[model samples]
Target: MAAPRVSVFPSPQELGPALAQLVAERAAGGGDRFSLGLSGGSLVGLLARDLPAAITGPATTGPAAPARWLLAFCDERLVPLEHPESTAGAYQTQLLPRLPGPPPRVLTPATGLPPAAAAEEYAGQLRQAFPGDDVPVFDLLVLGVGPDGHTCSLFPDHPLLQEEDKIVAALTDSPKPPPERITFTLPVLNAARSVVFVATGGSKAQILKRILEGGEEQPLPAARVRPASGELLWFLDEAAAKELNIPVEKHSVL
Candidate 1:
């Protein structure tokens, strides 16, 4: 895995617009369609509040056509779309409204299905959207790391870490809540054209140190998310990166 390119911000509030700008930059690269993978957590709220500012395009050349943005989940709770914990529900209620135009296509698993069944169904949806035996590489992925260094639903010391064949896999008894879930496997996660982890808060400091400075032998799920042919970046707030030993570069949306 390559060393992550780090972007540090003084606070989560400042990090939001920078993250939004990065997405706009990726989308502006001229794709017929832009596929974005979104993970659940505080990122949901941050993007909802700040991403819209970058969406004011039509009048100016900013991003790929707003209508071409196809958002998908990296992992999701196995709950009804109406459920408060549902990631898709939260994005629909929160982020979509922040966009300047009508919502783009959103691919989500059928609610109430068994975890395994839901995973297969979601994988099928991905295959149909981006077909072929090779992994479906997303245009950009905005992710979050749990305090335990988990990304998506893949947790520490979990067998799912070695998962290679399936694009998506189901999980049960996750260390975190909403136990039953479906997640995009590492192969797909690592194949994204660009991957960024949006981490904030002092609570993330220790794990940030571990994932960024620890040896590869001691791999954390979040650290495993290295894009093979694309960019791997970490956007952190000062509180989240305090424990790191490495230097950090600052960024601007401008």
Candidate 2:
């Protein structure tokens, strides 16, 4: 696995646009269709604020067009679309509308079904969307690191962490709220062309140190996310990077 590229910003204010720029560049350089996985949390606010800003300009016909993108949530709460906890709902209302040209195709989990059934249904959606691959390989996956080192709905020390058979798995005990959720398994996360983890605030500092430097025997959920044959990145604000000792690219305000 390749080592992650760590970029530290003065604050999330600066990190947001930088993250957006990276997305724009990835979308511009990849295949005709760009498949992207998204995670929730503060990342929602960050991307919703800066992604559209970074993607500005007239929508021209090209591989980089937003119309060709496929947007899927890395994990989603089993709640009504209007519910506050719904990741899909947040993006629909906030991020999608702001992008230029025709909107991207979005795949959302069936919130009405039971957890196991929902996971199965969502897996079927991915299979249809990426028919050629046994495991769907997304072009870019935007993930977040929980203070507990969780990513997606896979919490630390959870049995879900051992999951390898399912592309999507359901969890009833999320440690974090809403309890029930469907998340992409590590196989899918590791299959991405690029994985970027955005973490901010002082609450993330200690765990960032352990995840980036400790190299534990049993790695944290976030630490275990090393994309196979793909690039891994960590975008941290100064507050979150305070405890780190390794070399990092320090970004300035644009």
Candidate 3:
């Protein structure tokens, strides 16, 4: 398939509003529910800010407000919620309190399990949340690309990239610290209705160029994310888009 639409912003500040607008449109559609998969990274903080501003502003509203929005982690470190590394914990600290509601349904791995068991338990939670024909199609999945071109917990040259049987897997030897993690497999990630990769920093510029221009699927885990029936979006800051061979535009302020 051809490369998905790529949008470059001068800064993450510009990207935030666009992300908010997209989420608002999808949520307003009034599907059975709006499911979102989130990643834990610096980008998420910006997303947290943008999301509330988009939904809470003085916009015209009808009786049918968006309801039943669910949030899940695209991947998480198998640590307790209190742990500094826990993805869910980070979201709670950075994004949750800003929103108006109690909180979106957050699916987290069962605590006190061994690494492998914790991952399995989380996968089971996903299955239960999205069962049989009712498998929830994610309205939006926010992701971050690591310096090594990894997305979620899937890393460069990791065996999980080749996994096909399971929708989620446990990683015991991640190149990054806090090796133990639970991550959505390619199949599960590709099933989303929309996938947006939020990558910033000059450190990622070269890999971003390679991923977009090289065109060949390499060892980079981020390259494996291809939504089967959904739109794929890349939200890149100027530094991250510097090496890309495509023209970019600055978003006008509203």
TM-score top scorer? 2
Please provide the root mean square deviation of candidate 1 (C-alpha atoms, Å): 1.9
TM-score of each: 0.95, 0.97, 0.91
TM-score of 1: 0.95
Off by over 4 Å in 3: 57-67, 133-136, 217-219, 247-250
lDDT of each: 0.87, 0.92, 0.78
lDDT: which candidate is best?
A: 2
Residue pairs with colliding backbones in model 2 are: none
Of the two candidates 2 and 3, the one with more favorable TM-score, higher being better, is 2
Backbone clash count, each prediction separately: 0, 0, 0
Which stretch of 10 consecutive residues in model 1 shows the poorest summed lDDT? Answer: 57-66
- 163-253 in candidate 2: lDDT tens per residue? 9999999998888889999999999999999999999999999999999996599899998898999999999999999999999999887
5-120 per-residue lDDT for model 3 (tens digits): 88888787888888777777776666676788889878667877887777764322421133366788988887788888888888878877776544567787675687788878
lDDT of 1: 0.87
